[model samples]
Target: MRLVQVAQHADDLERAAAFYSALLGSEPTAVFDPPGLLFFDLGGVRLLLDRNAPTAVHYLYVDDLAAAIERIGDRAEVIGPPHRIFTHEDSTLGPAGHDEWQAFVRDSEGNTVGLVSFRAVA
Candidate 1:
Protein backbone atom coordinates (compact mmCIF):
# COMPACT_ATOMS: atom_id res chain seq x y z
CA MET A 1 0.00 0.00 0.00
CA ARG A 2 1.11 3.52 -0.72
CA LEU A 3 0.69 6.30 1.77
CA VAL A 4 -0.17 9.61 0.15
CA GLN A 5 -0.34 11.89 3.17
CA VAL A 6 -0.04 12.10 6.93
CA ALA A 7 -1.22 14.91 9.18
CA GLN A 8 -0.47 16.25 12.66
CA HIS A 9 -2.15 18.89 14.72
CA ALA A 10 -0.48 21.90 16.32
CA ASP A 11 -2.03 24.26 18.78
CA ASP A 12 0.57 26.83 17.82
CA LEU A 13 1.52 27.14 14.17
CA GLU A 14 4.78 29.09 14.39
CA ARG A 15 6.16 26.97 17.19
CA ALA A 16 5.18 23.70 15.51
CA ALA A 17 6.50 24.79 12.15
CA ALA A 18 9.88 25.77 13.52
CA PHE A 19 10.13 22.67 15.65
CA TYR A 20 9.36 20.31 12.76
CA SER A 21 11.52 22.23 10.33
CA ALA A 22 14.59 21.82 12.52
CA LEU A 23 13.73 18.30 13.51
CA LEU A 24 13.14 17.12 9.96
CA GLY A 25 15.91 19.23 8.49
CA SER A 26 13.52 20.36 5.78
CA GLU A 27 10.95 23.06 5.22
CA PRO A 28 7.38 22.65 4.22
CA THR A 29 6.69 22.24 0.54
CA ALA A 30 3.36 24.02 0.97
CA VAL A 31 1.74 26.21 3.57
CA PHE A 32 -1.75 27.63 4.02
CA ASP A 33 -2.23 30.79 6.00
CA PRO A 34 -5.92 30.82 6.76
CA PRO A 35 -6.30 27.27 8.08
CA GLY A 36 -2.78 27.43 9.49
CA LEU A 37 -1.16 24.42 7.84
CA LEU A 38 2.31 23.37 6.82
CA PHE A 39 3.22 20.52 4.53
CA PHE A 40 6.49 18.68 4.28
CA ASP A 41 7.62 16.28 1.61
CA LEU A 42 8.46 12.95 3.16
CA GLY A 43 9.82 10.83 0.33
CA GLY A 44 6.52 11.19 -1.62
CA VAL A 45 4.41 11.24 1.50
CA ARG A 46 2.85 14.61 2.14
CA LEU A 47 3.22 15.51 5.79
CA LEU A 48 0.23 17.64 6.64
CA LEU A 49 0.59 20.08 9.50
CA ASP A 50 -2.39 21.90 10.90
CA ARG A 51 -3.86 23.14 14.13
CA ASN A 52 -7.09 21.21 13.74
CA ALA A 53 -6.18 17.72 12.57
CA PRO A 54 -6.35 14.86 15.03
CA THR A 55 -3.07 14.07 16.74
CA ALA A 56 -1.15 11.50 14.77
CA VAL A 57 1.87 9.30 15.31
CA HIS A 58 4.41 8.96 12.54
CA TYR A 59 7.72 7.15 12.18
CA LEU A 60 10.64 8.60 10.31
CA TYR A 61 13.36 6.38 8.91
CA VAL A 62 16.94 7.34 9.74
CA ASP A 63 20.32 5.86 9.06
CA ASP A 64 21.56 6.51 12.57
CA LEU A 65 18.69 6.45 15.04
CA ALA A 66 20.75 7.54 18.04
CA ALA A 67 22.39 10.45 16.30
CA ALA A 68 19.09 11.63 14.89
CA ILE A 69 17.56 11.56 18.34
CA GLU A 70 20.49 13.47 19.77
CA ARG A 71 20.28 16.06 17.02
CA ILE A 72 16.69 16.75 17.93
CA GLY A 73 18.25 18.40 20.97
CA ASP A 74 16.27 18.85 24.19
CA ARG A 75 13.06 19.83 22.45
CA ALA A 76 12.15 16.24 21.79
CA GLU A 77 11.63 14.18 24.88
CA VAL A 78 12.90 10.63 24.50
CA ILE A 79 10.12 8.24 25.30
CA GLY A 80 12.17 5.11 24.85
CA PRO A 81 15.64 4.05 23.77
CA PRO A 82 16.18 2.35 20.44
CA HIS A 83 15.19 -1.28 20.68
CA ARG A 84 15.07 -4.16 18.25
CA ILE A 85 11.45 -4.42 17.28
CA PHE A 86 11.85 -6.62 14.26
CA THR A 87 14.54 -9.04 13.16
CA HIS A 88 14.20 -10.63 9.76
CA GLU A 89 15.81 -13.79 10.99
CA ASP A 90 13.21 -13.98 13.71
CA SER A 91 10.18 -12.31 12.15
CA THR A 92 8.47 -11.66 8.84
CA LEU A 93 8.94 -7.90 8.48
CA GLY A 94 12.12 -8.30 6.42
CA PRO A 95 14.72 -10.66 5.04
CA ALA A 96 16.89 -12.92 7.09
CA GLY A 97 19.87 -11.58 9.06
CA HIS A 98 18.58 -8.02 9.18
CA ASP A 99 17.24 -6.08 12.12
CA GLU A 100 14.83 -3.17 12.36
CA TRP A 101 15.09 -0.97 15.40
CA GLN A 102 12.73 1.69 16.67
CA ALA A 103 12.76 4.44 19.26
CA PHE A 104 9.92 6.65 20.38
CA VAL A 105 9.92 10.32 21.27
CA ARG A 106 7.45 13.07 21.96
CA ASP A 107 7.75 16.14 19.80
CA SER A 108 7.51 19.65 21.23
CA GLU A 109 3.77 19.60 20.50
CA GLY A 110 3.45 16.36 22.40
CA ASN A 111 2.91 14.25 19.29
CA THR A 112 4.55 10.84 19.25
CA VAL A 113 7.28 10.41 16.67
CA GLY A 114 8.98 7.12 16.04
CA LEU A 115 12.53 6.77 14.84
CA VAL A 116 13.35 3.63 12.90
CA SER A 117 16.41 2.17 11.22
CA PHE A 118 17.77 -0.98 9.73
CA ARG A 119 20.99 -2.53 11.03
CA ALA A 120 23.05 -5.34 9.58
CA VAL A 121 24.12 -8.28 11.67
CA ALA A 122 27.63 -7.77 12.98
Candidate 2:
Protein backbone atom coordinates (compact mmCIF):
# COMPACT_ATOMS: atom_id res chain seq x y z
CA MET A 1 0.00 0.00 0.00
CA ARG A 2 1.11 3.57 -0.55
CA LEU A 3 1.97 5.78 2.38
CA VAL A 4 -0.71 8.43 2.95
CA GLN A 5 -0.49 10.41 6.18
CA VAL A 6 1.62 10.96 9.25
CA ALA A 7 0.70 12.66 12.52
CA GLN A 8 2.40 14.34 15.44
CA HIS A 9 1.11 15.42 18.83
CA ALA A 10 1.16 18.96 20.11
CA ASP A 11 0.08 20.63 23.32
CA ASP A 12 -0.72 23.96 21.72
CA LEU A 13 -2.58 23.99 18.48
CA GLU A 14 -1.54 27.48 17.43
CA ARG A 15 2.13 27.02 18.18
CA ALA A 16 2.20 23.67 16.49
CA ALA A 17 0.42 25.02 13.45
CA ALA A 18 2.87 27.90 13.12
CA PHE A 19 5.92 25.68 13.59
CA TYR A 20 4.73 23.11 11.09
CA SER A 21 3.67 25.72 8.53
CA ALA A 22 7.07 27.37 8.54
CA LEU A 23 9.01 24.13 8.60
CA LEU A 24 7.04 22.29 5.96
CA GLY A 25 6.18 25.27 3.75
CA SER A 26 2.46 24.67 4.16
CA GLU A 27 -0.41 25.93 6.26
CA PRO A 28 -3.28 24.27 8.00
CA THR A 29 -6.20 24.08 5.66
CA ALA A 30 -8.68 22.65 8.12
CA VAL A 31 -9.21 22.31 11.85
CA PHE A 32 -11.57 20.28 14.00
CA ASP A 33 -12.78 22.23 16.98
CA PRO A 34 -13.95 19.38 19.19
CA PRO A 35 -10.67 17.50 19.10
CA GLY A 36 -8.60 20.58 18.33
CA LEU A 37 -6.77 19.10 15.38
CA LEU A 38 -4.94 20.84 12.58
CA PHE A 39 -4.28 19.31 9.20
CA PHE A 40 -1.58 20.31 6.74
CA ASP A 41 -1.02 19.27 3.17
CA LEU A 42 2.39 17.67 2.90
CA GLY A 43 2.88 17.43 -0.84
CA GLY A 44 0.57 14.53 -1.71
CA VAL A 45 0.40 13.39 1.92
CA ARG A 46 -1.36 14.77 4.97
CA LEU A 47 0.05 15.68 8.35
CA LEU A 48 -2.27 15.65 11.35
CA LEU A 49 -1.49 17.80 14.33
CA ASP A 50 -3.48 16.81 17.34
CA ARG A 51 -3.55 18.42 20.74
CA ASN A 52 -1.94 15.92 23.04
CA ALA A 53 0.23 16.08 26.11
CA PRO A 54 3.41 15.91 24.07
CA THR A 55 4.74 15.57 20.55
CA ALA A 56 6.48 12.75 18.73
CA VAL A 57 9.25 12.28 16.22
CA HIS A 58 8.27 13.08 12.62
CA TYR A 59 10.62 12.34 9.75
CA LEU A 60 10.26 14.09 6.40
CA TYR A 61 12.16 13.57 3.15
CA VAL A 62 12.52 16.67 0.99
CA ASP A 63 13.92 17.23 -2.49
CA ASP A 64 15.14 20.77 -1.87
CA LEU A 65 17.96 20.22 0.59
CA ALA A 66 19.11 23.81 0.98
CA ALA A 67 15.62 25.32 1.14
CA ALA A 68 14.47 22.93 3.83
CA ILE A 69 17.34 23.86 6.12
CA GLU A 70 16.73 27.55 5.62
CA ARG A 71 12.99 27.26 6.23
CA ILE A 72 13.39 25.86 9.73
CA GLY A 73 12.32 28.70 11.97
CA ASP A 74 13.94 29.98 15.18
CA ARG A 75 11.73 28.21 17.69
CA ALA A 76 12.50 24.78 16.29
CA GLU A 77 15.77 23.36 17.61
CA VAL A 78 18.31 22.39 14.98
CA ILE A 79 20.16 19.27 15.97
CA GLY A 80 22.43 19.61 12.96
CA PRO A 81 22.84 21.67 9.83
CA PRO A 82 22.50 20.18 6.35
CA HIS A 83 25.68 18.34 5.50
CA ARG A 84 26.64 15.92 2.77
CA ILE A 85 27.82 12.38 3.45
CA PHE A 86 29.46 10.14 0.92
CA THR A 87 27.76 6.80 0.60
CA HIS A 88 30.25 5.23 -1.82
CA GLU A 89 33.68 6.39 -2.85
CA ASP A 90 35.82 5.64 -5.89
CA SER A 91 39.21 5.51 -4.18
CA THR A 92 41.25 4.86 -7.33
CA LEU A 93 39.66 7.74 -9.22
CA GLY A 94 39.75 10.14 -6.27
CA PRO A 95 36.72 11.58 -4.38
CA ALA A 96 33.82 10.90 -6.71
CA GLY A 97 30.51 9.50 -5.50
CA HIS A 98 26.90 10.13 -4.64
CA ASP A 99 26.16 12.34 -1.65
CA GLU A 100 23.27 12.69 0.76
CA TRP A 101 22.28 15.52 3.05
CA GLN A 102 21.00 14.72 6.53
CA ALA A 103 19.98 16.86 9.44
CA PHE A 104 17.93 16.50 12.58
CA VAL A 105 15.71 18.78 14.65
CA ARG A 106 13.79 18.50 17.88
CA ASP A 107 10.23 19.69 18.27
CA SER A 108 8.56 21.08 21.38
CA GLU A 109 8.34 17.68 23.06
CA GLY A 110 11.93 16.69 22.38
CA ASN A 111 10.98 14.49 19.47
CA THR A 112 13.93 14.25 17.09
CA VAL A 113 12.86 14.70 13.47
CA GLY A 114 15.22 13.81 10.65
CA LEU A 115 15.39 15.27 7.13
CA VAL A 116 17.38 13.67 4.33
CA SER A 117 18.00 14.40 0.67
CA PHE A 118 19.85 12.14 -1.71
CA ARG A 119 21.68 13.39 -4.81
CA ALA A 120 23.69 11.49 -7.38
CA VAL A 121 26.89 12.95 -8.72
CA ALA A 122 29.86 11.96 -10.85
- Which candidate has the highest TM-score of all? 1
C-alpha local distance difference test of each model: 0.84, 0.73
Task: Note the residue pairs that clash in candidate 2.
Answer: none
lDDT tens readout by residue for model 1, 1-122:
89999989877777777777877888778888887888899889998888889998998888888888877888788998899986777556655787889999988789999988889887
User: What is the C-alpha lDDT profile of model 2 across 20-113, one tens digit per residue?
Assistant: 7777777798889678788888777878877763456666878876677678667578887778755546545223475667788876545677
Provide the TM-score for each candidate, comma-separated.
0.88, 0.74
Give residue 115's error in model 2 in angstroms: 1.3
Off by over 4 Å in 1: 90-92
Off by over 4 Å in 2: 53-55, 85-97
Model 2, residue 119: displacement in angstroms? 2.9
lDDT of model 1 at residue 79?
Answer: 91
All models, RMSD in angstroms? 1.9, 5.2
